[model samples]
Target: MAKMRDRRVAPSSERRKNPFAAATATRADKTGDSASDRKLVTSFVLLCIVVIPAVSVLLYYVKNAPRASHTISLAHQRGLIKTDVTYQEILTVISENASQLHRHYTYPVLAYITPWNSKGYEMAKRFNTKFTHLSPVWYDLKSQGTSLVLEGRHNADMGWISELRMTGESLVLPRVVLEAFPRELLRNKKLRDKAIDLILTECKEMEYDGIVLESWSRWAAYGILHDPDMRKMALEFIKQLGYALHSVTSVRNNKQHLQLVYVIGPPYSEKLQVHDFGPQDLQSVGDAVDGFSLMTYDFSGPNNPGPNAPLQWIRLTLQLLLGSPSSRVQSVGWKIFVGINFYGNDFILSEGEGEGRAITGREYLNLLEKHRPEFQWEKNSGEHFFLYSDDNHAKHAVFYPSLMSVSMRLEEARSWGTGISIWEIGQGLDYFFDLL
Candidate 1:
């Protein structure tokens, strides 16, 4: 039995020592090694083709993406964003801390308020007399046949006006638009006197400080300025109105002189043109009016989209209107209030799209939150703008007045020793008043 067992064990040993068997074993081992090596090569290739490239792409995105620290998310925390409560809080803080920011400018600030937006009412009440004049867009002077009618009295708020006056004694001038310019109203002497009397009676009866006349553009549109005789009549009408306003004493206070602020349009070009209101017109009516509110904004529109008011363009317009440093009219700078736009323009980069839609600060904030696009500061325009795509994949460009833009404009106006007339207070950020 031992011999039989040994014989079996000897076969096993012989099998282990057999060259053919060992070669077969080596072939099997080589086959296994080749399989493992193939797997390793395949994995490395996959890493190069998929995993590595994926990781590289992820790294690239991570590196290139806008950091949260630099985005509106962070800006919101810094009180750059607005809320009903945050608005008041931010204004309080600004009033306390940055009140002196505009001290470099000693000129008066004229802020416009509109009935369409309630924020303007709140802003006027809060800031009080930070504005020398508060013009409420409440009235329209229109012609109803032979008679002149001063409408929009329904929008007036006497309680609000009383409160605003008590706060800081800001002049409450209601903006009156010339909705209709009848030839008879300008040509007929009795009708002209009737118009002036109507304006004066309204001011005295309503206890209003004065009126902001916005008829130049309407007159221009009617081609009144084109005709030299009509232009002279129009200018004479303004002078008569101005003198009449200044001559009257306020019903509220006998000491106060009712002011007449004339709204003028920008030339919109470097060259001298027969515009709605030009330097010659200013020279004609400069002494009659308390201040000339130059509409320096709307430098661009949908048909020709660009900066709302380019800094360089504004400078040139000023030079053209007020004359260069060498020939600047004395004391005219004080009377000339440079217009600053608190609103922005949203323009579609397409033809026949009408004009740019006006946007407010809150709307702009909503857009920033939604798109989070890179806001670009155009040095040439001294404005902040951003590009976005809508659901239709149509590109839109927004040119809004940023804090920096306003500051540069304020500085520019200050250099000319001019006051600032904000288009409307409700359309801008609360902090914008910091640079008032």
Candidate 2:
């Protein structure tokens, strides 16, 4: 401490010229730059891996979520939700209860709409949401010499097509009873193939969802039912048509296979002499087609004085279809749709067989509203009737099904996990829509 050490200071020119010192300072600067570059690259990687996906998820949810006001308004319009509450309150309620009622119902509700019926378009618009399939009873086939041809022209109006499509429903081509029975066509393979080809071509051109084959042939006739040859021909024709139809993809729905529905009369009882369909035929046809629409109604018309479709008869008919353990019903219960009549049969008190008339559901409801007659609901039969004197001064008994009857039928269908279809639309009262 007492001795003073020699203080040596390097010249400024020497310090600037020292390459080692310069190299050391440059290494420190490069090390700091490398650390900053690593930090920037890490941040960029995290943004791509985490932040991008988070933003995408947020955008997807926003786009797909239903708007509260629109959903609430639609519910109110459908009479599903009451309008007594305030808009804000309804929004909250709808948000909370949306999952309970929003598209909750399963099973298809197919409605037959005839072009001749003036109310067809209006009814389609009014009840489009309720119907899963809208079938126009428009087309048929007829024998043209040795070949079969489309009989009636399809509806030219394309307006209904777009309107129905907008509702997320399908328009199926309905082939009613051709002038000549289909069995006759089936007898000739050449004619059957030609007919099926034409039908498939038309379906592809018109972009139909599928075809419906209605029961009109006497194949189910007592004489023909005993003929094994005729039954074999009929089954073969169905199988071929089904195969051809399914092979072609639908233009309307590319992902879905074409549907083939067979509409047949109710299964006959063992003792019933006037049976149209046998159990064997039912099983064979059921296996070939995508679904079976059982025409359980029309038990009585103007010709007979009875309920359109008595509950007891319906139950028996269902039993006949579903009774056999080896039958198609057990395996394909969901494919079977029980047909409901939206019309009624009116018989005059003095009329004999075939003396009464068939009236639409709207006509019957109108009578009830205008006359205000003593309405009677037969609980046991699940039918509604009223006694009134017509303009002819003759007593008349009108039998029809009310909403109550329809509800009972729906419950029956649900128990079996089966579907329900209406014979025709644009015939029912407003309240009937509420039940659906």
Candidate 3:
């Protein structure tokens, strides 16, 4: 994020007069007043008369709208309006209140748009230019016989992409997860070439600006990273994919080189083992890729039931990836896009409630209205929490993002001179756009 200049609003001078309250000069004599002058003065006066009153009326209604619940009833009774709009308005108001925390950052914001979260499509269009890259969770690489194929192409919204581009020039990079990685696919040259060709062909056909490739987590889960040969092959495959994407310039996108963003998993533990991608991996593939989308959230889960992502833990993860001054990875910080989670977790502290689930902005608002629990801030984690109970009397804990927590996280990412990445915009509140 860039450092913003400090601005101070100058106080109005005592001599300054209100344009509306100022007295109008009397009309000149017919002989003295030219036709053009008369016409100009009349137009100016008319404009003032119309605009001033309209603005005043708007301000008055706005100032009293929050306290005037009876207006809705009165309008409904007179058959002039419906409560649905009023309910929506109330929900918006509630959302705004929950979005009290606001901070401004000028970093490369890469946001993900999921098909499941319908709201995210509109959110992407609404905040079009705020993001540098929009990775719609659309495509996944799956095996069809011995050859690889790109699935989920049917889910792509071409109209929405065009609409989003009309607003801003954010690169439309659909996320492609490696779902069918054969055991020896990375080591096999022909199979690897086939996968790259498939990705390139799909991207070219769709006229996409680029793609966000996610495979590290899958590789780790499959224990591929545990094998030195396989890990090296995996990095080589990424480098080759990056080479293929970067070598071509899209004719549809004003002759811009196709971007390749590699998604990397965060350091699960402080020990910094080889099972996960570390600084060495970053250095190896740094030049091949445009940027690294670091999955930094999910510090705690249902098993532990703590903060979604603690501030201190995030710092440690970054430290591991970026390294210390003596062993710092050259130019790694600028290329890193730190992940930020807009949603929170609702953990079940006791039995009968079932497994914990992720909480959305709307769900968080509903809980606030239902429980009205007092919020407590965890200084160490830099998050806000509240406790509630269901009819069964089973306790639950919610660790949602608060104004201070979001502000601190943004600033922390800014301090590292790295970009910000939202897991998915749909799960976040509308007001969160204020920060971007």
By TM-score, who's the top model here?
3
Please give the lDDT score at residue 363 for candidate 2.
70
Query: Mind giving the per-residue lDDT tens digits that candidate 3 earns over 215-301?
Result: 877777677778888888889999999999988887566568888999886765445667677888899998889989987776554
List model 1 lDDT by residue over 55-93, tens digit each.
Answer: 322322222211122112222345543212222343344
Q: Which scores higher on lDDT, 2 or 3?
A: 3
Error of 2 at 106 (Å): 2.2
- Against the true structure, candidate 1 reaches a TM-score of 0.75
The per-residue C-alpha lDDT of model 1 at residue 178 equals: 71
Per-prediction RMSD in angstroms? Answer: 27.5, 34.7, 22.5
**Global lDDT of each candidate:** 0.66, 0.56, 0.67
Measured on C-alpha atoms, candidate 1 has an lDDT of 0.66
Q: For residues 31-130, could you state the per-residue lDDT of candidate 2 as single tens digits?
A: 1135544443233222111011223223222222111221222333554432122224323333453321232225667777766565756776766776
Worst 10 residues of 2 by lDDT: 20-29
- TM-score against truth, every candidate: 0.75, 0.72, 0.76
Which rank order by TM-score, best down to worst? 3, 1, 2
After superposing candidate 3 on the true structure, give the runs of residues whose Cα lies further than 4 Å from its correct spot. Answer: 1-103, 325-328, 351-354
| TM-score, prediction 3 | 0.76
Best by lDDT: 3
Alpha carbon lDDT of residue 87, candidate 2? 27
